[model samples]
Target: MTASLQGQMMDMPLTVSALLAHAARFYGTVEIVSRRIEGDWHRYTYRECERRAKRLAQALIALGVEPGERVATFAWNGYRHLETYYGTAGFGAVCHTINPRLFPEQIAFIINHAQDRYVLFDITFAPLVDRLAPQCPQVRGWIALTDDAHRPDMRTPVSSYETLLAPHDGAFDWPRIDERSASYLCYTSGTTGHPKGALYTHRSTVLHAYGAALPNALGLSARDVVMPVVPMFHVNAWGIPHAGPLAGAKLVLPGKDLDGRSLYELMEAERVTFSAGVPTVWLGLLAYMKEAGARFSSLERMVIGGSACPPAMLRAFEDDYGVEVIHAWGMTEMSPLGSLVKLTGEERRRPPAEQRKLREKQGRAGFGVEMKIVGDGGRELPWDGVTFGDLHVRGPCVIDRYYRTDTSPLIDGWFPTGDVATLDADGCLHITDRSKDVIKSGGEWISSIDLENIAVAHPAVAEAACIALAHPRWNERPLLVVVKRPDAQVTREELLAFYADKVVKWWIPDDVVFVDELPHTATGKLQKLTLREQWRDHVPPSARGDADCPLTDVSTDLNADHAGCVPPSDRATRSPP
Candidate 1:
């Protein structure tokens, strides 16, 4: 005999449209604010946002966009971009957010590969659109994300977003879309090869939004004022767009202005209670606050992602500014929400020193995320808190295959995350290094992330990176590259002594090299590949054992006038990024 399950439940589809509908129905008066590209504040309510989004949907249908077709957007984090997100995906069209920070050729390649039918962009990107339109022949039209008054002249036939929505009266009916239908498409930054698309479905996105709002994650709510400094083009701004509406939080978008002063002014004016961005943005803000003697009155929680948050940074915020720093980790392939570094009740009960140790990790996986580590030959590694291995994850939001690719990127239903990490029995995860960034010296593996973090903790060092260089005795050795803070005077011996107390001697970098600046990715990740190539030929002093070779004295004073003592062979080519 078969047991029957309850059948009285309502069949509501878990689509993005449903989220916006819920916001409009329950929190119609919730404010959605935007600092427009025109250098002014634009305010609206959830009800108005839904109305405009519906009108935009009608405009898209009038433009001949069909179900499953792709509509690309080149804009920042603003109200118009948010409208594009809901408008395209609400009526069944896939919203493809393009990263305008990528090289022009990469942009052209992505547009052509996605086969986008129409491109909607902000006025700031109109010149870029004009240059890339001729290369993408499949694009049928372009729409500027602004009023006609602020539209820029372009070679392609362009229409203002205001004009497109003005003809409709919010009368369009949204079709019942399958929850598994594709809703959004984003590409990886392509550090190694060509960029690959990660397509996300309506169910995955909505579920991710729900998981993000969990108390262990962002903890979003109706009373919070949220600001997302991460661009909307990057992994849906780490899923803030959907989570904000789902939780009915007031959103403040900074359009085309990400300077420290600008962000601080906006946050102070709006009384932002929660904000999310990369570490570089936060570093700039910390510098601004220090320079101007400012403080955060309303901001209680700050989510730092896109890269690891250094322990020094975490200390700076919590110890000095009275802010709770939530260190997060994710990727474009994971719907961009993997884990958040939050303390558990048991962990928080420990001494303050022990709590700081726990906060140094990337943290346990968020709700709906499953993670494990595997060694060579696909052997499962024990969660002993010390055994590092290849990181793999599986969840409702993780991608199984890249877009338009016939090959699957999974092994036995788990996706390899291309990171080397360790997990403890308590479910805490520590990211040691990326798979490619790990250095193999002699027979031991060295974590560049550890060295970089320790170096940046020095009062004189502003930023740091570690890369592998050729060695005579060891197959490779770690080299520290650094940028000094203004008026900093620290010797190599001082830094080495600092590390002697913190790490094993073998783990310390063999030599220290100072640079005016380090190369960084558009997302603020250190460009180790470029750094490796630039210094591949430099002969380390350890390999040569030549005391005569020009080397910076460990006892010499470091000042702005000091030209770095470089080896004779490499002196000519050494320059800034």
Candidate 2:
């Protein structure tokens, strides 16, 4: 290679703006498609996306969005969200993605906590904005990201996003971003106290996008029509929005509506080769496809995360519908990418069942990531499948702290993910416990995952969430909440008895509450803390495994036990979802 070319490659500081420059110059005509609003599709080339993103930058700058300022976006996976990804960061501002799934109060708290200066939100969230605007402090401007979906002529002033860029030059001179400048911030899926922010750099985001598109990562390319079902407000849609451009891939944005029908219709119509979402979204789509007696002919693979990917779900998609479900895991601290379960050269030749089993693990750490398990005393533990410990990761992309904020939980430069995991001989990581969700009983740690997995194993159970309660004898005990399937009858005792052969005697949940539905977080994770707050005090005295038992509806009983939003504890008294 020429000396000048080699120096250029070596000295190049990878940044989101730099990636856009490359894509804009090299592959401008590559398509970036999206299902705008719902049921409707819009197509824009990568060049156009970059151009519009530049206009957006011009608009932000014209609106006085200074460097180091926080620009918040309350949006889903869509074109506007994608534009904000580049536009905000392209001009050296931080994009604070407010999770639409977070409760309105939490949403308000995050906006206030981040001290966002300007807000750009999808029209679908206007009601939430109306409810939350009073609490937001730093916000001086609000831009509505819609043409008609959720717009209204309100007395409060908010400019239209697209209209703001109407007069601005589509040609933009992207600022030379500083390496240390914070490019984006996505809060953790806070199951505990207030959500902690993980600040990502222009460098880290660029590197992450590169890693995500590698064959060993999400394996993206220009030919693939990609849809990131993971919300845009969450970890840059798992980094696919930028990754698509960096890798020259076609992107499909499923705007605000992520229902199964909408997603499936888009997938088939767009000929989406790859997609990613949580298990709940995939499970819903699979169910919908099966009900309609249809499947995607062009659909290839899906990367599942934000939660565990069940072995059965993966197997069904592969065998029944011919889709490969790759399980990936990461945290907000780690630029949202820790590992992907891509098969190796040797593993690819393995039997289908064996390959499926290996893919179910969280997979090994990626190129830029470092992993170690720390035991109770904080010593580094070995990667033995049986020895589950607190998983700690440190890397270039991993955040050292929240930007311009104090969250005491961040420890020792390594963000405590509050997740417990086990790594096997092959470097495959399997999540065994979520820190708070793990039940500690009689001095032994119990994986609530074990209980929840077993609970879901019951044919009649639709969903299950297990939480710990303070017990007089043991430090804490477990309570299981079962959401029954449609027209299915499952007594608490029957459900508990189903777990007899699965887990150890002492590890079984002490109480099973048969509610119509289990509480879920915005990301579709079971909200165990909510369950703990409801059922922690009053224990169901009756044993759950007995076959000959009368099912008492605990909905009324639990309401009497607690004055507030009580979790339905009655075995037969399922509440409306």
Which is the leading candidate under lDDT? Answer: 1
lDDT of each: 0.87, 0.78
lDDT of 2 at 526: 78
Using all chains and alpha carbons, the TM-scores for the candidates as numbered come to: 0.93, 0.88
**After superposition, candidate 2 runs with Cα above 4 Å error:** 1-10, 147-151, 349-353, 406-413, 470-476, 540-577
Looking at model 2, residue 101 earns an lDDT score of 77
Score candidate 2 by TM-score against the native: 0.88
Candidate 1 residues 269-291, lDDT tens each? 99999999998888888888888
lDDT of 2 by residue, 338-448 (tens): 998988999999997788768878898888887777775566666757676787888898877765566545456565667888777888888878776677654456778
lDDT of 1 at 236: 97
Winning model by TM-score: 1
Q: Quickly count the clashes in candidate 2.
A: 3
Kindly give the stretch of ten consecutive residues in candidate 1 with the minimal lDDT sum: 554-563
Residue ranges of candidate 1 with Cα displaced over 4 Å: 1-8, 546-577
User: Could you tell me the TM-score of candidate 1?
Assistant: 0.93
